[model samples]
Target: MDLTYSAQDDAFRGEVRDWLEDSLSGDFAGLRGRGGPGREHEAYEERLAWDRHLAASGWTCLGWPPEHGGRGLGLLQQVIFHEEYAKADAPARVNHLGEELLGPTLIAFGTQEQRDRFLPRIVAVEELWCQGYSEPGAGSDLASVSTRARLEDDTWVIDGQKVWTSLAHLSDWCFVLARTEPGSTRHAGLSYLLVPMDQDGVEVRPIEQLTGTSEFNEVFFDGARTEASLVVGEPGDGWKVAMATLGFERGVSTIGQQIGFARELDAVVELARRNGAIEDPAIQDRVTRAHMGLEVMRLNALRTLAGSGTGSQGPEASIAKLLWGSWHRGLGELAMEVAGGPSLTAQGPPYDLDPFQRLFLFSRADTLYGGSNEIQRTIISERVLGLPREQKA
Candidate 1:
């Protein structure tokens, strides 16, 4: 398999690198490292403004077809853009759910009207989005989604709870997975509906994390309503559409995430040097392993993207999830180790965690969110290895 970038691709990479360098240098320099994974609350409005600046510059949604308000960039160029953005330490994006997840899903499965209604807003960052997938008992077991919606004339009324919904409190829209056909069970009778978040019946309560931050929330949709036409695909087709959205989640954007991961690793390594933790053989060994593992992850993700293109990743996406999740959690622990005794104490009595401390705490969920490692393993085993499905009790 070819891993080399074409000369044209390399030139595109240079263009991306130059653009990011120019974009993040002056007025946006303060946002260089803010509003990332665990710190979405940092300078949030500023980040929102920065995201609009990106939209204005036409830097968003590079992989979508040009007819859909995108640049229609190829796979390698998209990868290059993400890589350069991370290298430039660009501000954390404020619209990943809308841009990365939903936009591509619509391009593939959504009706023309759905595209016309949503794609431009998503491209322009006019509406922020959150995934309404995980529920109280159905975090990774999507077929167990208990949220229910029923059509009422021109609207669909929804009622249910969604837990661990990222950015639900801040989102202007939610794409919900609900049971539309009453008695059907296990992946049937479900629908993917796009619901607005500002109505009177919707409630979002922030879920505080171990890092003392709340990037996700518990949302209660009590008699919430949306137009009946908002369902992404036909009824009973949520499983297919939702799976595709999740597949899109594992796309080239992760290269930017890995670049951030590399920065964290570098910090840990520098601490090891200054604090003399590098002298410890075990610490040295773990550090080496972490660096090597990240390289492996980069290569594997490139291979997966090359074959799958944009929105249609297969079982290999599960492998990508499992690899990065475990590796990140391990890096968090290693950060604490390298920080030595100082990692335990916060800056204030109430608590102000240093970056490493926050990383250690926040990365704890790396294996849990966006499909748990256990779920990824199950997908790989059942779909790739020809294994039988595990029976439910």
Candidate 2:
């Protein structure tokens, strides 16, 4: 991967930086550094407005094709935009589920009508979306999903439950995977359906987390209905389309996530110094290792991006997931350790968790969610390394 930027890329970076500084100053100033992981409950309405503001300025979907209402920027320019946005500590994007995951899926797999109907709304920040792949039984084993959907006269009827759905309560739609063929097992006979969330057949209940937040939720679809044409790919081809979405999930946005991770590590280091934990050899060694790991992680991500196509990522994306999931979880542990005894206690009566405390608690799930560490390793071994597949009893 080229480490040097051309003059045009540098100019583009300046444009992004200037826009962020100018726009985030007055009315949106309070949104800076708000509504991230563990803090998703903060500034709900305000952040949604900030998202719309981003859309209006044409900064929302920088990488999408111009035909789809995006700027259609090159890969390096998109990278610069994400880095500059994170550097400004701008409000966490509220529409990432739509922009990053579902938008690309539609462009790559959706029919022309699907793209015409969904892409513009996604770019405009008018319709937010959530993923409905995980269930109580199929958290990491997506092929084991039990959600079933069948086509009636004009609509597809859905019935199943999805857990760990982030921002379901605020979303306007859900892209779901369901069994459309009876007696089909594993990944076969599945269809990817885009179901609306406001109908009477759908119910959403928040799941409180260790951080005392309910950003994640449980969605039950009794007889939820969507247009039969809402399916992304042909019936029984959901596995291919869903896997492509997963590839997009781990795409260029991760570079921005690593930038955020670096900021978190910087905070941890500052805490260690203030508490004199930096003087301890053990603490110092761990901090050095964390810093080095961040560098390695960034390099690997860039390399992966270089090899990946514009719309889909390769199996090497699993390596990125494994790296960051483990690194962020370790950073959380380091934060608590540097804080020492004070980290053990809540500062207030309501059991409030400070930023570091929340980091420690929320990062515990990093290696578990998205795809578990075991699942990532399996993908790396079987798909990337061409190892023999694990024997299924």
Candidate 3:
């Protein structure tokens, strides 16, 4: 409940703010506001270089332990860093899957060899990683994943399709969930394997969105191979490890996402005023609700991090997802309303959209991806509220 920052916290925030303001200039100046949610395709090569720059400055994995090549920042300090980074309008990061998801999972569940092999690369931004959990049939219902992998000759051969994989085309490695035990169903008999994406058997086809951008991709793993030792936890324990990774998905970096959301809200408000849409009472009410929702989200996320401490998430994580997803989607509606008829048409050329247009289009998927709102409600009901699971037919 202590929302106030200590003097040390204030100093840390100032340090973060100063570093970002200074470093995001010169050669990195163009990256100030590039590579955000719907704009990941912007200046990607430059952003990769920016990631390495962050790694070199020891800013890649601020929440990780010191032994793992991180700043070992506390929860409050981590929040401050993310807030400052977003406030500075620093470029959206490229190595988040590796730094935020895989690094922590490796530290927590990976073997010594796995940690030694992968943790340093993650810290140094030497290799990028992607999540391979969702499949053609198992986007949110992970228990039904159809991807299968078999162990043979000290390697696991994987065969399946993973859809909507973010950055799969650019990633060096993928932490995949596949069925290892034949005839197993639901959450059982699955293995979490770290497979390389460069092999010939792997194929990545970018999935173009309504925004005419392809930040997501369809990855085909046809006999994709990885060392048997690459599995994070024991075989057939992917349910546990994968769920743990889902928990990590809602870690401290979410504060940075909220800051970004705040920026988006500001943009929408500015658009309303510019277009004179603010005169509409309904538009004004929606704008007010969006602002209030952002505050509530930040508070809820802070409370979650306080109790959960950057580790695996509790049921509260579902609430966070639901809240932010709906809020962003609503903002998209508001943006469209503010833009009026102008929002319906592309700015120019072969399917190009301005920022507000892109936001409106991309936000449509907000409620669908990363555990859909419906699935989040199910989690909240069964896990958080202790409701009985609906009987399956």
Q: Candidate 2, residues 154-202: lDDT per residue as tens digits?
A: 9999999999999999999999989999999998999999999999999
Q: How do the predictions measure up, each by TM-score?
A: 0.98, 0.99, 0.98
Please give the range of 10 consecutive residues that has the lowest summed lDDT in model 2.
306-315
Q: Once model 1 is optimally superposed onto the true structure by TM-score, how far is the C-alpha of residue 247 displaced, in angstroms? A: 0.7
Residue range with the least summed lDDT across 10 consecutive positions in model 3: 307-316
Clash pairs for candidate 3: none
Angstrom error of the Cα, residue 58, model 1: value is 1.4
* Candidate 1 residue runs with Cα over 4 Å from true position: none
TM-score, prediction 2: 0.99
Give me the runs in candidate 3 sitting further than 4 Å from their true place: none
TM-score of 1: 0.98
Report how far residue 329 has shifted in candidate 1, in Å: 0.4
Q: Could you tell me the lDDT of residue 171 within candidate 2?
A: 98
For candidate 1, lDDT tens digit of each residue in 1-393?
487989999888888888877888677888998988678889999889889999999999888889999998888788889888888888888899999999999988999999999999999999999999999999988889999999999999999999999989889999999999999898999999999999998999999998888998999999999998999999889999998888888889988889999999998999999999999999989999999999999998988888875534777889989999999999999999888788989978797989999998999999999889999899999998989998878
